[model samples]
Target: MAEIMLLLVFCLLIAAAVIFKEDRRVRDELRTQLTQRDAELADARDDARRQTAEAVRLKRLVVESGRSPAERRQLDEEWQRLVASDEVVSRMREAGLSPERLVTSAADVATVQPLLERGVTGEEIAQAVTASQALADAVSAQGSVSTLSPAELVRLAGLGQAAERSGKGEHDWPPIINLSEAAGYSFAVGSADLTPEFAERLRSKIAEEVVKIMGRYDAGVVEVIGHTDEQAMGKRESNLDRDLIPVLSGKTDIGTLSPADNAGLGMARAVSVARLFRTDPRFSNVTVIPLSGGQMVLPGDAVSDGSSARDARERRRIEIRVRRPEQPTQP
Candidate 1:
């Protein structure tokens, strides 16, 4: 009986040892899970705070005038400043969007967040923004956007479709026009120089577009954006996504400037276009903001689909958009 008792005690000790080992492993796993959860919670709090602040700013902006010319100009600048924030731009880049191509406002940034969260592409977000703005603009003359009737909404969509198709006096209605389609002259491969024929092309196609946009939208500023394909420039290897700050304070001559990659080349091209418009009497006093899209946008303002390889011709293009002010003049 004593021997039996000793064996039982020994068994108990082994069982205890097994339980202790299992407990230690389980405790370690729980600790790891706790750490992960804590980090997640912290991230959630940060995002919530940022979103709250953004909501407040948007409310204030909305309360401000969007119809008076001076008030509208101030609002445009405010919108530009908000969209130009690093966090917003970073979000755009993560979604394979070129921030340069986006005609952003405070509302656009807010609308983009939920779309990004749902894994929607930036190109889709841009389309949504465009459609939303069209409806909003139509309602401005009648009343608040919230009071838009169903028929008005349908009309806005119809107009959007019409704009997408053949627009009246549409020079570059799609915004993204292939150079081959828009320009008459050819540059000896990889050159941004606008020859006499190219100049005429601008005068006919792009200039006309600017005039129509100015007349129709009463826009204060016209942004000229340039894009190129994934093709390599010259014989050197280079990155295409680098930025070129617009030469706002001085002259931008296409003949004198030599850029390295597709992005730089695109900037030079856009600057060339801007310089052309600057001297034109039609665009006199009108602001032309040039931006480089490089090879970021595929045909039809779609974001690149992660393929470094494509029909190079389709991506070589230029796009334009107008910024409307509250009480905009001809410019």
Candidate 2:
């Protein structure tokens, strides 16, 4: 009876241990499943939010893309009203054409369409109209209205006129100085060297005149721009080799030296000129700025008279631009 009782107690102890281990394993598995379920729920919510935002963006795009027909019609009407204004008509007149003719004639459509397509806004068109009216008034006052031409139109607009000129068509601004006149200022042969006489004239006469002009205008800054001919750099085997070449080549850097050389020459010339003006006490307040204009602004080339050498001289000259200081406003 004692042995049977001890065996029964041992069996009960082993059974309790097995039941506790099974309960612990089941509890761990349930916790892992709950964690996975929570993660899945969060991921679904995130996906739904992203999908909703994208849908909103697409809907906005669709709404914006499909404008109402009525709105488009309204825009067209506004554009037509703007183009049909008296201001536009006046601009056409200033451009050397009758406004009524421009509107009625089919030939005028070609001209109007191009100006419109060139990114000229309605406001610009209106300003052009005003300018045209002003020019017409000026011409009428001068009693030269009959002499008006497209070249005159460009002059009134403060723009460079086209090359061609026809009687009764247009009048261009007269050349400030012809190439022959400009060339007569100095005789500079090749290689950036100026004759002593030329240098003296530039320093004494031109520089002195510029100083007097600046003093007369009470200008604070005088910009001295240097221009040059379109000549190639380096020695050539023939005169034909004097044509311009690209600044860069894989092997030699002779052309690269051209810019520096040109710039130095320009600076030296400007300094030589400035020295004359600086001698005067009246010009002490003015500042001089030297700049190289490269081969730009071929002023004489506007008239193609087969005088390239003469035109080249006009290109190779100096310009003086004056500016004044901004005055402070008094309260």
Candidate 3:
């Protein structure tokens, strides 16, 4: 009876150990499955969040596209007004600047930021705008404008390339200088004679400015164009065809030569100026060409309406222009 009881206890112990091992294996499998399911659910949630964000962005784009251009512009202006600091808005108003009139381009914001921080005044802003408008007019007349922003110009100042252009019909041209005769640069009524004082001014002031401009643009040519009014030289004898060479060669004085018409007078004056430039060491490597604009172009480069007028001082001027040399095309 004692042996049978002991064997029964041993059998019970073995069965209990086997049952505990099987339960642990089943628990580990269940835990692993639960962990995998949790991982899958997290991934699904992330995907759903991304999709929701994308849908919201697309809906916003669709709404924006549905608005008219003017409405969109108004909204943009309103947004700009709202985002501007209260102090800035007040200062701008005090300075007579309309918030609606402020058109800030993406590139312009960087330029305007510092000005805003430093409290730019109305007068200064107006002056800047006026100067910008003048430049824009000049560029538009040339059929293209510079693509460089203020920041880019500052950076390129070191490279001697403050402005540049690309694409068809676009050009990076130097500014034209229309030197008025009334501004202390006047010549004699009918002669190409340049006074000592006027010559000195040309050499010192005008030449220096032209040299600076040339340094900036690296141009190779200088053109001196002479313009005259509708004043007719009444049947005066012209020795220009015979004496032009001698006058330019310094063999004969310009005073000895006579121009019969306005065209001859304009040509004579241009040649005199070109000679001065050619003799200057600063313009030695640069080609200086003399051109006669004659009396065909009006004060603002307008064509003559065949209306003859005498002693129009405003129409008498010397125009100086600079240009780069043309490159030869490859075969």
Candidate 4:
């Protein structure tokens, strides 16, 4: 009975040992599997991080490269072709989804279409037609391509066209002919009276060319400005030289006359000349405006230098200045 009890206790001890060994083997297997899973998880995280970094770098590269309008158009056409191709469609199906996300966004697509039709390029179009709003916004912010509005573009184009036309020698009107000498008419003498010799010379040369001058300039009006030297009538007094009124009165105080009074005398002289032109039918189209320079612009002296009669000839002079109709009207 004692031997049987000892054998039974040994059998119990063996069973317990076997049970403990099985538990240890199971724990070791579980620990190995957990270690393998942790390694796989770490590898997956590294690969995901690498792929995310690569994507971010590609996005940055796309944003940095500025594309031209021509390039943009080409990109648009190429994208459209790819989207329409069977290869893209098949790949999209294999991926278990439609290819909407891969396709260009509507706004970007719209921006590129017109540029493509206008002969823009692929890389340029790709820059504009990205899914990334930040990229698109960055490109748009550059203000190089899309800065000008449609109206501004049209206006600039028109100006360029006009400049080209001008360079090509297109003109709306004939070239103006500037007369070599002064126009209108003038006569110088000892008095305001018109000399017959002066009238005859004018009737021949000026009156004959009057029609030609009018037609050439398309002049609506003609102006005649007269100028004279500083000379006035001498004052009269009782008793000194009674019969010498002619010489003394001629030597009047020219400096004392006011501008208005001098201008009046000049106007009268111009009126006399105008009357001569008006009498003839050739000057019918000419409208005469009379003005005065008073003593401001003196006539050139016909006498030789150092002559005592310099003042005498200076007082006996007249002037004429011809101008176009478009000349600004002086106040």
Candidate 5:
């Protein structure tokens, strides 16, 4: 009887151990399955959030595309107003154009679009518009307005790049310095060296303009500015922000020296022109300041680089203007 009781107790102990081990295995598997399900739910939520954001962006684009024509026309006039605002006009005069009126015509937009296309705005555009305009205005103001013949206006407009094509036409960069107005001389593309022909033309053309401005205004200084396209004259991989003065000098061989970028090229050209100005006895009466705009202003006052637009000829030209140092106010 005692032996039977012991065997039964042993069998019961073994059976209990097997049941406990099986329970643990099932519990572990259940916990793993739950963790995997939780991760999948989290991934699904993330995908849904991304889809919602993408849908919203597409919806906004659709709304913008449905704008009515009348709304667009109103926006156009508002755009025009922004361009003609007082701040813009004041900035324009500061840039050198004294506009008789503030309204922008179709031609104005045509002239303005190039600058607009190049991410130029507000005062920069105003300055270009005015500079190009002032170039025309200076020529027009030199003689009586009424006396300006049709042929002369046409010619002046062409050379000054003051022509206002319809805004709808293919956008083209106007000339910076009208070669026709500048005695038929222009710089070679991608070059700052003064050609023999360019040298002869500069001597005569600048002499005439300098005489006119000096006689008509209180100006006593002739500023010969060098402008260039955005193309570099130095290493393509170099930084443009660095100063090129170290490479340029009164005695440096300009032909051999590589200007780092547009600024260097423009300055070198301005210096070249300035050296020529010093040689002439007529320019001795006024101080000559050789300055560089360095692709700042384009033909027709639009802003661009050689890479930005295809109007290389105009962007690559030089300009001559009169500068009047401010006089001291009375105490």
Candidate 6:
């Protein structure tokens, strides 16, 4: 009986040892799970912090963008004022006037108003009168009375005379003639080639007006300048260097061009317009120079101040200017 009791106690001892081993294994597993859970929580916290920071940064940007610079505000105001009424623009078009001419007239008014309010000196008035008389004499000689005021008449005459006197108008340049998109000189998006209607207008309306202006000035070079708005052009391979000559020679179409940037696009469009002038019989003796103004120049010959970012039709334009050809270098 005692032997039996001793064996039962040994068995209980064995059972206890097995139970302790299983308990230790379970505790280690729980500990491992807890540690993994803690690591996951830490990662989640870091992610939330990053997300919050990004949100704050984006909100700040939004607020800052809403507040435009003072110059930008001023530019916006000027643009609003200079923008012509659609009805008036239509009337001017019917009168065979360029829409940009309206802007010029408005700018002139804006400039003169401030000067008039400050009052003109007697000396200035006298000079203006003499200039006007001189202009009238010239008009009378041609059997035509100018519709311009005596002052305006003289200014025009002076511009012409100044050009004529400056080494046969080689030194002095004439006012730039802006052919804005507002004047129906529009292009397809991302295209440098002129549409059929665009080409027709250039040959018929624009060329005729330009010829008349050139007649007024002793010009030997016609600078065709292309201007673009401040829209960002995405990355693209440029074909200008490889294809410019071919495009000019009619070996390739201008429509196939892909400019990498605004500057190249401007140059390509300028070249396209210049090609037309180069081919025209009227401009055979004159050099047609193509130029790119890019997005750096604003209307009224001001440098862009980063005031505008929207798509402005008025900003995308072609400007024609007349100048005397450069004199050849003496041998």
Best by lDDT: 6
Off by over 4 Å in 6: 1-172
Q: Which residue pairs show backbone clashes in model 2? A: 91-129, 149-169, 149-170, 150-170, 151-170, 151-171, 152-171
On lDDT, who's better, 5 or 6?
A: 6
Q: Cα deviation in Å at residue 17, candidate 1?
A: 99
TM-score for candidate 4:
0.31
Report how far off residue 131 is in candidate 5 (Å): 41
What lDDT does model 5 reach?
Answer: 0.66
* Model 5 quality (TM-score): 0.38
* CA lDDT, every model vs. true structure: 0.71, 0.57, 0.81, 0.55, 0.66, 0.83
lDDT of 6: 0.83
lDDT of 1 by residue, 1-331 (tens): 9999999999999999999999999999999999999999999999999999999989877776446778878877987888779778898799998877665565767867897999999799789889888867767766555586888778976876775675533344324334642344344367667678777878887688778867764466777777887876676543323323333323333455667887888777777777778778898868888888888887676788657765465566666677654465696
How close is each model in CA RMSD to the real structure?
33.6, 28.6, 23.9, 18.4, 30.2, 36.9
Candidate 3 vs candidate 6: the lDDT winner is 6
1-331: candidate 6 lDDT, tens digit per residue: 9999999999999999999999999999999999999999999999999999999989866765777798557766775766756667888789898988667699765766675778976478679979878866777776455456767766867877876675445444576788888777877787797878889988988888888768766677889999999998988999899998788666888888888888888888998898888778898888888899999899999999977878988999999998777789999
User: What total of clashing residue pairs does each candidate reach?
Assistant: 1, 7, 0, 13, 3, 0
Candidate 5 ranges beyond 4 A from true positions: 1-184, 188-190, 232-253, 305-311, 328-331
| Per-model TM against the reference | 0.41, 0.32, 0.49, 0.31, 0.38, 0.48
For residue 261, model 3's alpha carbon misses the true position, in angstroms, by 0.5
Candidate 5 residue-pair clash tally: 3
CA lDDT for candidate 1: 0.71
Task: Report the lDDT tens digits of candidate 2 across residue range 1-331.
Answer: 9999999999999999999999999999999999999999999999999999999978866765686878657766886898778677777778888866655887757766788899988689889989989877887787654477867756855522222422111333221212122566553543334456666765666656766555544457767655555554344332112221211111322222223343443443444344444555656677766555545445543423333433355556666666666689999
**In model 3, where is the ten-residue run with the lowest total lDDT?**
161-170
